[model samples]
Target: MTLKFGDPDLEGLKFLQDDPLVITPIIGNCHVMRVLVDNGAFVDILFHNTFIRMGYNDSQLTPSDAPIYGFNHMECKVKGAIQLAIIIGEEPREATQMLNFQVVKAASTYNAIIGRTGIHTFKVVPSTYHMVLKFPTRNSVGEARGDHKMAHSFYVITLRPDRTGGQPAEDLVPIPFDPLDPEKVTYIGASLDKPLKDRIKTFLQENNDAFTWTVAKMPGIDPNLITHRLKVDPTRKAVKKKKRTYAPDRLEAIKKEVEKLLEARFIEEVQFPEWLANPVMVKKANGKWMMCIDFTDLNDACTKNCYPYQGLIP
Candidate 1:
């Protein structure tokens, strides 16, 4: 008989209440990590960054045409998919099967998310009140317990907005100064007209928390909400070039800038990262050097977004 949510096996769970269902499951035979068992989601998502951390390569992804949407109904970019063997229960009760997951460039508190499709695949019934997932393997019922405290923590983490080091380096264009509040400023391409500038300045000053002037001002987005992940092609062999040396002055400036970003929690150190890319130093017109990652090789592997450009025609 197929397992059902209200099965008598779950009756003992009525005593518990008020917690989201969360559990840690092993993936690719790696250490067990937390995954939010969300029956509401139609698709299972394995974050690109988390996939890399779990020792998976980008080439493993099988291109998926179906796009996934977030709670806000915005279309999320799907990099690809990979099939992995998933095990739910322990010992004789264990049920293992190959599962396909669509990889995305999202960051979340959970390493992986198992959605309704995954739940159905395991033929399991999940209960938030019981904090457990129940399924029948053979004639016996198998149970996977949920981590209540962890699930609640992840719930709080996903609500935050996405943020990065003072905006992306590509958007480092000239900003307009606030006339009324001399200390304030607006991002690139602001209206040059004095009246409009003043109005923008006043509005910004009124909503100061919305504007971040320096690294100290940035309240980064929750990693779970949105995260930047480079989809490096794993099929391509890894490349590591010798570190390029820079002039003393330029090196000093890079060090200082890196320190500021680190202090602001915009970037964290990672060990033995895969998909190496060289940093290119560009000489700005102001004689200062700007650092940018040379992702030419990385870009070659990604699916391009072809938004047609209409030149100067109204």
Candidate 2:
């Protein structure tokens, strides 16, 4: 389909063509905001701050020795790399793709950068002048509009020398509970005094049970105390999605994970279910395959909770 930006695309955008096209796209399970669409970049990038905030551990990153240079031709340290599912545009017209992103330690106003690689992968036609992106879908062209105001705000932040470092307000340093197994560790405020840090580390080690190191260590909540039920509409017809095939290696990983869950009594086999969904394999930063269920049909049939709890109650 022919994709073109018109006057409607420039409705809310200012006449300033200098503003970068920044869009918010669903990356993995998070709706990552302030993602710069830099066509000049050679690869997609995920900033370290955003990666940590997304609940990922540094150990999850796949090792990469290769380095990448910035626009200024200066070499930037590569933290590692990760693959995540990215959805651009809204449903019915949206396109989904698993993209490899280089995670960088450098701080930036933006959480991620979708570069030329992503643009080509999505077959997107981007118009920086209109601050919009269009890509071909199954039926028609899908559109992802950029936030001009947010882009300008970030631009201003970049100009500020005090804020441009992109460093977090508070830095965290990792402290391993078991020196033998460095993988089992936790983070503490880097600014803390040496004595305070030692005390905190000791406290954590003493109460190590509080930290779940593996799935086997997880003591699941009792259903008697609290249980969740899907408010599925009865009128909605059940959907049985077709089974999806996976690579042999991914299939093996899925099998192993499923077995582990089954052994832990976390999941049980159900025969001849009315509504069925296929499992999706998402590659983790650690080069592991994570199985996820496609619950779109099930979610569509469920009613939204308008009065969700706002905060904790005594």
Candidate 3:
């Protein structure tokens, strides 16, 4: 009864939240994290600052047995087993895979979490009078781009240069922002006649498919179900904040040989899809292709919020 963002609720696509709840995780091959399908959330994850840029070390965190809520509910304080690997829903399936290692953090963003004590051992189902959320087809995983693919969620268009007196407006400007790195879509303006940077490099070499979209209307809440609250920013005491400026054996040797320029190495250390820092790979056979980046220097050092394509368009 509260899902508005482009409009299209024919009873929430004929009530289908039974499985395929929008979850993603793929560490070495890359896809990092795309969480949504919360199974009741008890204490599944919390890593934030990109898990310290992924080498995680709050003095080698170790303090959780289970229990650390604080999204305003207040309780905070946890540091338990975080070995890794919850791969989920697809890939050489072995019960959709599991090996939490020992993740323990209540509030999230560190790029790791799947709470409800592990979504109540996979039996989570929720519709909320058609808000949508259900996962229980033998603990569903893989092949679930459900809800017409979350109604196409990948917004971020920041291209500006509609100058008025400063001189710089040859027809190339558009703005839209969300950018949590959902498969990417950040243009931040200024390609001049470069034509929206050639239509954002042909929308990442045509993969997000025509990037074809028309659903306009998102201010807050319900872009296909949203639940938020996560913060962990007040550092400098985890051993004097790791003795000054990030180090955990230098990010574990930069995450054990950081040489994965993404071949679908979908970059995911807390969603690095800020476009791409090393994108430029090309290889394909039956299933493989490259060209995915639009981070644009962390969206030009962040801070320009978008939304300026209103009134008319062809």
Question: Which of the numbered candidates is closest to the native, going by highest TM-score?
Answer: 1
Each model's C-alpha lDDT?
Answer: 0.69, 0.82, 0.41
**What is the C-alpha lDDT profile of model 2 across 54-167, one tens digit per residue?**
989789999977678865567888999999999999989999999999999875678999988999999998887788899999969999999977775553355333311234
Model 3 Cα shift for residue 252 (angstroms)? 42
Query: Would you estimate the TM-scores of all the predictions?
Result: 0.53, 0.51, 0.20
Better of 1 and 3 by TM-score: 1
Better of 2 and 3 by TM-score: 2
lDDT of 3 by residue, 38-65 (tens): 5455555645454556656777656556
Q: Give the TM-score of candidate 3.
A: 0.20
- Candidate with maximal lDDT: 2
What ranges in model 1 sit over 4 Å off? 2-17, 155-166, 169-182, 188-314
lDDT of 1 by residue, 1-314 (tens): 65555555445453343556777777778655777788878888888888898888888788899789875677877889999888887878878878888889865666778988898898878877667888878748888878755654453344332333124424333344456666665563343566776666567567766667689567879889998776555666666566788888878878877888898987788888665676666676567777666655555454332111112111
- Locate the minimum summed-lDDT window of 10 residues in model 3: 235-244
Q: What's the CA error at residue 12 for candidate 1, in Å?
A: 11
Which of the two candidates, 1 or 2, achieves a greater TM-score against the reference? 1
Output the TM-score of candidate 2: 0.51
TM-score, candidate 1, is 0.53
